[model samples]
Target: MKTKNNIRVGISIGDINGIGGEITLKAFEDSRMLEFCTPVIFASNKVIAFQKKHFGLEVNYNGVHEASQAVEGKVNIVNISKNAPKIEFGKETEEAGKYAFLSLKVAVEALKNNEVDVLVTAPINKHNIQSEEFRFPGHTDYLAKELNGEALMFMVTEDLKVGLMTDHIAVKDVSENITRNLILKKAAKIHDSLIRDFRIRKPKIAVLGINPHSGDNGVIGTEDDTVLKPAVAELFEKGIMAFGPYSADSFFGSDSYKKFDAVLAAYHDQGLIPFKTLSFGKGVNYTAGLDKVRTSPDHGTAYEIAGKGVADYQSFKEAVFTAIQIYRNREEYEELTSNPLKKASGNNR
Candidate 1:
């Protein structure tokens, strides 16, 4: 099934000091991976060499100038800057953060210019990567700004899909941020993603409550009734199949998340804690409602295992698979919508 129009995946080397290099190398170690798509990594040749040696990887990569020249069965590294920062494993430093941003910045530019079909970013330390130029909370926020679109942090896997409306924000401000308008916007984005990217034409979404037991009918709090219920009604009026201000605890407890296409949580840990708990090494963090495809591993930089070659690459591999699937699904969805009789198909992405 390999074709000339294989989707190109651009990968960003995360923290030079972390396991980004390890997992990335491991993910592409199999030559069969190239059968699906060509991969372009944004990192200096010197840095990649260090990572390969340090991790004792057997895979070989070709240092290419641009994404267009990427070769199948060969890892292509788009060397960003002739020189790169020093690698200091198990330690957080400014240089690690700088090069991490550099790799991401270069890969993002390639994606924006249509040189790459999708972006698969590695993990970066949110604290260390913060600079005056890059001030966003994480990849989702930064890409949302650069790409000029709202991003829903959609965590995906074979089993379930969960979206966080309030991500990377403090818990104290969670209640104040759950406005009706914000709910509607996130709901719309989720709907669009399910239809276009996931190929679910008539998708049903479940929304979780902000407070305990959905405010227990105003005993625990009032926002669940005052904000969430009305927001769900408004979304229903707009023809979106959104339900609940469901209780955070009981929803996942009873395995009710299995009943919907996607679940939108009021806050970060309210959803991710359970998602990660269930699908830790297999989850793909996808940024939906964007002009281009972007995904990352559900986990973060594990400095303790940096350069050890023991990091599990399953999540990173799933990220690449998910990005490619989304890109293809979006293309097919557009094709079908553009021509009704062309192909009324069900997706396997």
Candidate 2:
């Protein structure tokens, strides 16, 4: 029901020792970005100054103590910490992890309170960020819990959209996690996101197999045949347009994914490897089915080149753009659904 001309994007400056700050600043280097959206980075002024000095950057940001005090047309730094820990590039310390959690926690709180429209998170070191405060595997789980919604790790790009059924779990646990209900839930989220977030009508979803050759007609494994096949059939019966437990190995190689609107992979690597391989620098990881918009770059914290100022920001930029677009799409969808004439007009066009 609420709408705005300029989207307020809340950003969580990920690991202070990593390339998160570098990429966040680089994404806003082009002043043209501020024309559409205002970025509020949940970080301390000390950390920003340290990184700026290290990179020799001369960017201007509005340093505010609260989210409501954020200014448009500039990077808004919401100071979560007074005296930031010392700068230690290319190093993983407890302090870096602590700040990373603080940044994410504050940004998410702002998002929950509707202080911002969407969230674009920077790269976080999984190992370092694991403290008593944040015990989840990654951002997806934390965001899901905070927003009171399920998270589908949706890898989005111009070429394709891939969603994982199981995320951040080990190989041993993947099989146990792949249940009929899990598949159905992820497929529904991806399907709903296609229509609501991406504005796709009549989405055709492709399902990837858990085993090689879709379990080779039950000669290898029966999960794909027994579990996945029935799940796809159920989805199709509900008018979801879902198909196949196709062999993961050959599906991408054959370029068959071009025919579908989105693909549901059985596990993490089964989906991400191919998605990242195709759109390594440009892909955006959208957490679909969340009440609020949240997205991240496909890549992680580049500790090797933390202070080199060479980390690619294309993916981060795309994540920001994707969050804005999804918010707009959601608003438009609500407007159309509320009015019969507008809904009819939209369908006709």
Give me the candidate number with maximum TM-score: 2
How accurate locally is residue 151 in candidate 1, as Cα lDDT from 0 to 100? 87
Q: Give the TM-score of candidate 2.
A: 0.97
lDDT of 1 by residue, 1-349 (tens): 2254478899999998888988999888887888888899999889988888887787788998887778776789998888778899878999889889989998999999888889999999998998988999999999998895888999998778899879999999999998999999999999999989887889899999999999999999999999999999999999999999899898987999989999999999999999998896899999998999999999889999887778999999999999988888887777777875565443332
Where in model 1 is the C-alpha error above 4 Å? 1-5, 343-349
TM-score, per-candidate, Cα-based: 0.96, 0.97
Deviation (Å) of 246 in candidate 1: 0.6
Clashing pairs in 1: none
Return the lDDT, model 1, position 143.
96
RMSD of 1: 2.3
Residue 176 lDDT, candidate 2, scale 0-100: 76
Q: Kindly list the per-residue Cα lDDT of model 2 for residues 67-122, writing each as its tens digit.
A: 88888778899999887887788999988888899999999999999888899999
